[model samples]
Target: MPKHPIAVELEAINRDGETQVVRDCGLPVQGYSVYLRAVEASGLALATWIADYDTIGPAYQLAERLSIALAIPLTVLVPEPLMPVQSGPAATTGVITMAN
Candidate 1:
C-alpha cells in the first residue's frame, strides 16, 4: 500500500529573536523542504521539531535521527482511533451499518 504524507513542524527562532513554527508536508524521502526554506530565509535556530503521522515508521525514525544529530527536541504525534458509539436501537438490535 502507498504511504500517507507526513507533516513535519519546527519551532524556530529567527535572527530578530522572534519565534515561529514552520511546517512541511510530504513523503519521507522528500525531506523538510518548507522548513529548510524558512531556515535559509530567516536563519532560524530550531528549538523543536514535531513529526505527525498515522503510524511508527520511516518518518518517525528519520525524525529521531535528525533530532539527535541536530540536538533539537523531537515530538511525535500519532492519532488514536475513535471508539464506536452505541445507540438505543442499534445497540440492542445487533445490526451494524457502514458508510461507503
Candidate 2:
C-alpha cells in the first residue's frame, strides 16, 4: 500500500511531538467536530448521540421542532451503525461467504 502524503506529514510531526504544528495543520478527515458540524448543518440539532438504535421519523420531528422553537438551524443527531471489525487470520483475505 502506498503511504499517503498527509499521513507521512502527520507521522513526522507526531514523532517530533510537534503539538503546535499539528493544531495548525488542522484535524484529520474523520474528526468529531467535522461530523458534528456537518450533521448540524443538515438540520440535526445534536452535539452527540446516545449509543442506542433509533427510529428516524421521531428524531427528525424533534429536530425540526427544536429548530423552530430556538429559531436556530440544527437537526437530530443519531449514532452511526456499527461497523464490524475484521480480525483473526481470515481478516487478511477479502473473500466473504454468504450462507445459502
Candidate 3:
C-alpha cells in the first residue's frame, strides 16, 4: 500500500545568498505541521503533501491554518502533468494564493 505523508520544511537565505533548509520537521501521517520562521529575506515555511486528488482539500486546509496562525500569506503549488502543446504558448503552471 502507498503512504501519504506530509513533509514540513522551514527555510531561509543566508548572508551569502544561498537558500538553506533550517529545519526539517519530518513527515507526519496526518494533520498540519507548523513552524515559525524569520520574516527576513527568503524566510518561509512549507508543507508539501503528495497524495491522490481526493486529498487536495485537506492540503489546502493545512496550509490555511498555518498561514492564519503565522499571520502570513499562503501559496499552493500544484504540479500539472506535462502534455503536448498544440498551439501558441504552452500553459504555465498554475498557483493558488491566499492571504491571512
Structural similarity to truth (TM-score) of each candidate: 0.29, 0.25, 0.30
Which residue pairs show collisions in model 2? 43-74, 43-75, 44-74, 44-75, 44-76, 45-75, 45-76
- After best superposition, candidate 2 residue 68: deviation in angstroms? 0.2
**What is the per-residue lDDT of model 3 for residues 71-97, given as tens digits with 9 covering 90 to 100?**
555543232211123243321222232
RMSD of each: 17.7, 18.5, 14.9
Q: Which parts of model 3 are misplaced by more than 4 Å?
A: 1-54, 79-100
Candidate 3's displacement at residue 84, Å, is 26
Among the numbered candidates, top lDDT falls to 3
Q: Sort by lDDT, best first: what order?
A: 3, 1, 2
lDDT of 2 by residue, 1-100 (tens): 2211110001112333332122322232121111111233344433332111133333333433444444444422222221124456633332222111
Error of 1 at 59 (Å): 0.7
lDDT of 1 by residue, 17-76 (tens): 333332222212222211211132344433233443333344445554554555444433
Candidate 1 segments exceeding 4 Å error: 1-55, 80-100
User: Residue 4 of model 2: what lDDT?
Assistant: 16
Candidate 2 global TM-score: 0.25
